[model samples]
Target: MNTLSKKNDLIDEFDIIAKFFTPLAKDAPGTFGLLEDAAILPTIDSHQEWVVTVESIVCNVHFLPNDPFELIARKALRVTLSDLAAMGAKPYGYTLTIALNRDLSDSCYLLEKVSHGLTIDQAEFGIHLIGGDSVSTDGPITLAITAFGITNKAKALRRSAAMPGQDLWISGTIGDGALGLQVAKGILSKQYSDLAGRYRLPQPRISLGCRLSEIAAAAIDVSDGLILDASHIANQSKCRLVIDGGALPISESVSRIIADHSEMFELILTGGDDYELLFTAEPEAIQKIKQAGYELDIPITRIGRVDSGEGVDVLDHNGIKLNLLIEPGWTHF
Candidate 1:
């Protein structure tokens, strides 16, 4: 793979597909030989540790072809990194899997886009792209990435550790990505181009999530929409989640977009693609998060709490349950 140019043809096309990775193996299980640039598995002798996560971005499903290619690369890498951040992982490196359509002759263009995306993010996080795979197929373009980070495994935040009475919190604003895509499709207009930017290039709250691990009981990135991702944490922790409808932290810009459509709250609530972090913490930690200095342009809002039940409820300001046709957001049929 060429690191700097779009002219380098895709090479090292491995036909012998590697064996399917087990969940543990896929998680970059246990430490191994740690070199200066590559990962050196920590031992009883070494204090450093590692955590791994893998994610994929498919063209038709996760993004659109007309979407700026550079932004596409940014979104794909950010999503994978979001997963790493949720685990309180300090990024070390990443591996990519690219499946290009056979009809596309210039694999170089895709590589260049991918590299550009990685470079921008690496500058901020100090992570690197150490290795990857490139293959051709009849399917839509797909980019899969596995990112590794060093963290204390015992201290890593988990999705199943939320306790009842813990407070629920989200980083940054919600619903921009969902609304942004609508603008991109011309379903909406440039009147809300800022919203469209949210969809095309979700700024993952990486540092915030990493810091929250020090206090959060459980955490997840809001990729599958807040409703679905929150449900995952609720169900896993066996607690009921009560989210206050009005407390959702949507941008004023998104509110303007919704002003045109009236059904704005619904889209923001269920719309997927918002790569923010959703986490549960002890009530006492709420003030600390506010003081942590990670607030983005939009503020973090506390929407609900973990309760002693099995599902999530959306309540209005009066504490009445709100009616929603879409119970959970963005489920694949």
Candidate 2:
């Protein structure tokens, strides 16, 4: 086993992966998981390949320590599933790794609840657990999951395919997860329980993503905030992304927060963890995209456009750039 060692001190997650795990996959062709969002494994059949992604959630960092074990477990699984959803892959199965603190008397109960949560989502998404590992830890409880799916398309969607003149679109409403966190922390009113629920369980757009490979030029999940994630497409595709702030789709829960405090709009843009799909497609495919969304019963909205330039620009309805208070999205570093 490889460990991250910086003169015996641990470095950051990205650094650790790049220095340790990346080298392990050097000879493994198609195992670009370190360089890209997911790893692709070629199969015997030419038409399909395995798309695999893994993510870890910590007790206090990703979710509140005291949050329901059930919700935490669902989030742990769903976040990895969201990665598969971004690549237009169909769920197959997953492996879970849990580091538990044995000192807690309710550890068994918590494990039961987490397993129950996983069972519910597995049935809902039509996926199953293949294998996993568990161990005791004196530190905070941590959960890691490796999820894999299969895509029948000749090629899974990539973040580097967007081109100038394409339209930027998003599935489902935004800002719910960010606002939901505030609601969970009691920073905002609890009258908006939907917002809190959104924070707890994100609806991964798996069905819509499966259909989008043929329509979308590029796609990514908005786990790091809309502006930040859109910037990823911009940087990857070498095109400028201009998002219309006015065109942003907001749910009733988000609308309520904005109605009371307009400043919350910043949260809507930069707040991360929505896990919704943010994608780009040519204008000619707009009708087909909408048709697909309708068939999937998911609302798709066009809120921006790709243009010839650099970076991402967000403009108000008046077409004036709004000065941002902070960086566009969440950064682990």
Candidate 3:
């Protein structure tokens, strides 16, 4: 693949596409390696097997401008891929649209670096670049990716499927992404680089999600903050969720930091962008779910349970619900 341009600046639209993007579409059927007007998805068992989702991210909003090039590119794709994971889907391919900021002085370098990152992640995630568009923009560097995945026909998971009395669980630890952002802004020491890594290169829980279709009644990836996402499950399912504040799965580093900076606990609850999976399943499936988590090596923690109410309740050691978030009608009153 022609990964770079000899010139220091982007030459033209076609030049950019030929050098950077076409190789990404390589070997995916019907894509013509992005050398066509449109593309067709690889044929599946049925239309019901297809799961499609799209998400757009802007520099300095979803990600910082100075973050590594590959990270930014991977972040854009992983964000969209997580949507499919939430639905218990394996990746098919994706089309990306990149709007390059005119203000960038090193546009060619940026494109080269971003494309290199995309190339690496495409291979890692087993996805092909089907097709996409690139254009100039007066605003910040922005990317919109439309991702496709495949799942068992009619068996995709949904946020609105949780029922009262089901157990609530999450994959991986939380707060790392939020803490990572703080590290980026220099609010924390470099000892917390792991947290920052979580922010930059989020590992989508595809294995956990794929296993969940048979185990979970409802599922959603934790992109927005944990409490916010859990509220989505409750609101959509028209049930209440009660979580124990002390039971949230946290890493050793996070536990140490929280012990010293008690007030920083809020970041764990409200700091969004952790791409872990939050799901609900029947109480009887606890052992089965734990087995799946063990087999997958992704720790699964049961933080709460679905209840017959309208919102979310996070109970403290005193058994009283805490008003941690000000989201009216969503948090327990």
Predicted model with the maximum TM-score: 3
Each candidate: what lDDT?
A: 0.74, 0.83, 0.85
- Pairs with steric clashes in candidate 3: none
Ranking by TM-score: 3, 2, 1
Encode model 2's per-residue lDDT on 1-333: one tens digit a residue. Answer: 122222323445465445434443444456553555445544536678889899999987889977899899999999999999999998777767777774666654676677778878877998765545555667888989998899875669899999998999998999999999999999999899899899889988898889997789899999989989999999999999999999999998899889999989999899988999999999999899989988998999999999999899999989998887488889889
- In candidate 3, stretches whose alpha carbon ends up further than 4 angstroms from where it belongs are 1-8, 327-333
- Pick the winner on TM-score between candidates 1 and 3: 3
Go through the candidates in order and give the C-alpha RMSD of each one to the true structure. Answer: 6.1, 8.6, 3.5
- Supply candidate 3's per-residue lDDT for 69: 81
- Estimate TM-scores for all models: 0.85, 0.86, 0.94
Off by over 4 Å in 2: 1-44
As for lDDT, the candidate ahead, 1 or 3, is: 3
Clashes of 3: 0
What's the lDDT of the predicted structure labeled candidate 2?
A: 0.83
Give the alpha carbon lDDT tens digit for every residue of 1-333 in model 1: 212122335443231112211111233423221112234443522554678889888887889888877788778778888888788777776776777776676665665666666667767767656556556666788888888777765778889998898999888888888888888888887888988888887776667766776878999888878888899998899988889888888888887776777776787888878888888989989777887644434367788999998878889899999887465788767
Lowest lDDT sum, 10 consecutive residues, model 3, at 1-10
